[model samples]
Target chain A: MKYCSHCSNEVTLRIPEGDTLPRYVCLHCQLIHYQNPKMVVGCIPEWEDRILLCRRAIEPHRGKWTLPAGFMENNETLPQGAARETLEEANARVEILDLYAAYSLPHISQVYLLFRAKLLDLDFSPGIESLEVKLFEERDIPWNEIAFQVIRTSLERFLLERRTGAPVFHTGKIDRSPI
Target chain B: MKYCSHCSNEVTLRIPEGDTLPRYVCLHCQLIHYQNPKMVVGCIPEWEDRILLCRRAIEPHRGKWTLPAGFMENNETLPQGAARETLEEANARVEILDLYAAYSLPHISQVYLLFRAKLLDLDFSPGIESLEVKLFEERDIPWNEIAFQVIRTSLERFLLERRTGAPVFHTGKIDRSPI
Candidate 1:
């Protein structure tokens, strides 16, 4: 936001009249620019009694396991994003059953939305981003080596709710500091 | 992505002789990286036969009308994100009714999920990122000036579904060209 959109002038970051945080304000248009976090949508795609998982072929969490997930694209709906990610990562078609989890990480400025999906077919292979694609039963999850905190939490909740057959809702800020 | 996780060393991004797209290949630790998109969730909150709309105080479309929406946070559900966005933008509580629309836009790299929610109370005001907040009947919607293509399409489908009682399930690229 170095340039202003209204008057085509350069902008600067400054605190407003009654604010504490610095904001990007266009000097020409007097408009304040607000930046929000990006969104991630994916699914816990299931076939029979097992949940789908992908092995990463990239950095940040290379070789780690994760649900098929990705950043939301422009002009697409959440479900569409989830479904597309599933196909892109696992090469599988799925039917979204319900939205299972939503997570906000203010630390990284990201929000993740996950859903429970039923696999439309048993056939699947690694997509461009995945090294290997596989399914795991609840008890067989590789908990310690899961890719991200959000993925672990969503998987835990999904397994718990499935076992108890009860609706589950959890809300709290994550203590991200490492032990 | 070109390095092994177990033994830190350079790897390849080339698919095997019989494979399609290039994938991360670790020669040492045999690790791969998986890349996926994020998810965004929001709601079309309706109050007494009118829909809640907010004038965005931020870009990509500053001062444009839109439904209350934001990225899904970590450790929350899709419904929770939708409800949270509704509250954050409208200062109103809502009960989510049904999953309304899902869209995928590979161009801008986002997936948006939307829900239909019944406003719990009509009390609301513009939140931090909104210049103004108000409700409008279907016919009175400012379709041309809606903030995002996803929002415009979702609102159109929602209104049409409300009238014709036929659900909309779109699966294709969204026409995101400026109006």
Candidate 2:
């Protein structure tokens, strides 16, 4: 940040007293602006044996297939955020089951939380941020066209655990080294 | 937020085009500042038949006992954040096991991710943010003096699941109504 949002004064980066890391502190107000990682929540909506996928119409892997997800909003639970993202992107209603996968992407400062959900009905269409929405079986999934590594990892685990009759919780990190 | 951090110009809250929620939009740079929830990560450090706790030396819950938890920083995974918090607050190094409980506190816009961990050794002392650090068995826990509801919930579940041999992944919401 170039300036403080509180006082419109220039901000300087320094480690605050008793703190190990540097933060943007306002010169006048001394307001510390701390930025933490954001969460991307979504669901694996299962209909019969198929799963829902949406083709992105926005940038950052636009036109690629993804399991409808987005940046979570304030004042909502993770499951609620996941369901809302599914509805916003695919116009599909779902009954959330369990939080299946959580991947920390330190490179992008994001955590991806994906849930296993059951599609309410066959009535689904593309929303504003999606070009198309469709259900894909295991063999039909476009693995090579998945939007993000986190999504691909979650999808692969979800599909594999589906055959085991019971799904186990999965947690891991996706580290992309700095240049 | 009063001024735009991008250009040091006044920012107004308005619903941008194609968006349903209002955001702080800069008048000079047209930058949209979006605020989302942050993650608080820590662990339930298990040592023999006891778990660790820290007496708060910081504000918001000064003097109250709590798990060694704090706001997660960037460039770290959930497990790493949990382990770091445990070490920083209690001077206790841990071997993180599984992510046990995830709670979404919408009222405060924070998510708590608590893990099950094994304390590496018995040599732990209070850190700067803690007045004292101690290990408590299930019957000796200071339930009423717990700092936060999320900590209480996590501790209760960890103790209960200890007898069951396996801890199921727990997810829930904490709603603190305005007084």
DockQ values per model = 0.11, 0.86
The digit string of per-residue lDDT tens for model 1 on A1-179 reads 45443444566889876444577776767877555556777998988879999998887798999999987655466778789889989999999766676566666666666777999998999998899999898889899888888888778887888888953433324436211
- Where in model 1 is the C-alpha error above 4 Å? A1-11, A15-34, A166-179, B1-179
Q: lDDT per residue, candidate 1, B10-49, as tens digits?
A: 6567775434446666655665533344556788887777
TM-score of each: 0.55, 0.97
- Indicate the TM-score of model 2: 0.97
Candidate 2 chain A has its poorest 10 consecutive residues by lDDT at A170-179
Against the unseen true structure, what C-alpha lDDT does each candidate score? 0.74, 0.89
Winner by DockQ: 2
Tell me how much of the true interface, by contacts, candidate 1 captures: 0.16
